[model samples]
Target: MELVPFKDTGKAPAQNFTGDVYVTSIKTPTEPSRLTAALVRFTPGARTNWHSHALGQTLHVTEGVGYVGTRDGKVIRMRAGDTVWTPPGEEHWHGGTATTFMCHIAMLEASAEGDPTTWLEPVTDETYQSAGN
Candidate 1:
């Protein structure tokens, strides 16, 4: 048993997100592991750019309402305690609702080798609005 050091809550880079967002590292496997966890917070109307992990990702909502959208224009509305999963290489984005702040614990599987996360273009406003907020 050990206590890992806490990381600073810094703004999420625009390179991977749209609008203002922040993330704090909760756990990062040092060796013989490929799992990572983060506590991500999104401001109202903020969200991630379309992206996917090589192995997949899971999100567990902890507060407020969250929006999850897929490449096919399907948006899932999630509330506190809700859990969502994105299969390997599936394009999607997740974030806060238009009028609420949102936070979730993101679990990502690190690629073994040669495979990496594929990031796609940003989600357009037209598609965002279609999610019905």
Candidate 2:
């Protein structure tokens, strides 16, 4: 096994995220590997847009508090050591709560065709505010 070098953290794109968020690459698919992972951090009130994965996704909370939500209005409060999984093709969003900064390790596998995620519209302020309700 080879050790991977650390990479710099970067801000999450405004096009796909609301408020302040950062991401640092952990691993990316290479050759026979189809897995991808990253360390994602979010400031209070920051969140991802509605999105789905071709092969599903998993997130493990590492610090602070956050919420994971779905189109069906299901919201899960996640704290450090908590993990959540979203099945393939299910639209969802995740991020920090209004009063807490959050950090999680995001993991997923690319589809056979190499596609992993499809991002959709941003989660509305009303929707974000209603998380966990």
Candidate 3:
């Protein structure tokens, strides 16, 4: 087995994120490997846009508190050591709570086209506020 080199941390694009978020690539698809993984950090009030994966996604929280929410209004409060899964094609968003920072390892499989995620519109302030503290 070969050790993977560390990748530089990068800001999650504003086009797909709200507030401040950082991502460090942990694993990227190589020949015969469709898996992709990253360590994502979110500042207070930071969050992802509504998006979905072709093969579902899993997140394991490493620090602080956060919320994982879906189109059906289901929301899960996640804390350190918590893990959550979103099934394929289910629109969802996740991020730090308003007063806490959150970090999680996100894992998913890439689609045949090499893109795993389809990002939709930004979650509005109203929608975010509704998520509660």
Candidate 4:
């Protein structure tokens, strides 16, 4: 029964993303828990680099349109209230579309020992355009 101190929204690190982005961490469970949550916002045409969670990740869209793409060439267009899940080790990237700001609550679980998130190369114009965005 303790309160977690809220922190100010911060700019997302370029090391983990491709363009301008920001995030505000909402919750990170203590030692006994393994969950982490954040409110992530992507500027128009901004997105994350291809990466995957060790356990998995879930995103609940809160506003604007979102574009999610996988290596399989599928791009999912999601809107407010839409939920998207990426299974463990699935390579994918997500962000705001060409003309809108997007926000989502992202949830992730800590991975077991010896298994961590794997980040891949940046998404290229070829791949991004392939998404039809």
What TM-score would you give candidate 1 relative to the actual structure? 0.94
Please write out the lDDT profile of model 2 over residues 22-122, one tens digit for every residue: 99999999979899999999999999999999999999999999999999999999999999999999999999999999999999998987679999999
Worst 10 residues of 3 by lDDT: 124-133
- Candidate 3 residue pairs in backbone clash: none
Clash total of candidate 2? 0
TM-score, one value per model: 0.94, 0.97, 0.97, 0.92
Q: Candidate 1, which segments miss by more than 4 Å at Cα?
A: 114-116
**How are the candidates ranked when ordered by TM-score, highest leading?**
2, 3, 1, 4
Candidate 1 vs candidate 3, TM-score winner: 3
Query: Which ten contiguous residues of candidate 4 have the minimum total lDDT?
Result: 110-119
- State the RMSD for candidate 3: 0.9
Global lDDT of each candidate = 0.87, 0.96, 0.95, 0.86
Count of steric clashes across candidates, in order: 0, 0, 0, 0
Candidate 4 per-residue lDDT, tens place, 31-114, comes to 777888999999987888999999889999999997899888889998999999999989999998878889999998876563
| Candidate 2 local distance difference test against the native | 0.96
Residue pair clashes in candidate 4: none
**lDDT score, candidate 2, position 5:** 93
How does model 2 score by TM-score?
Answer: 0.97
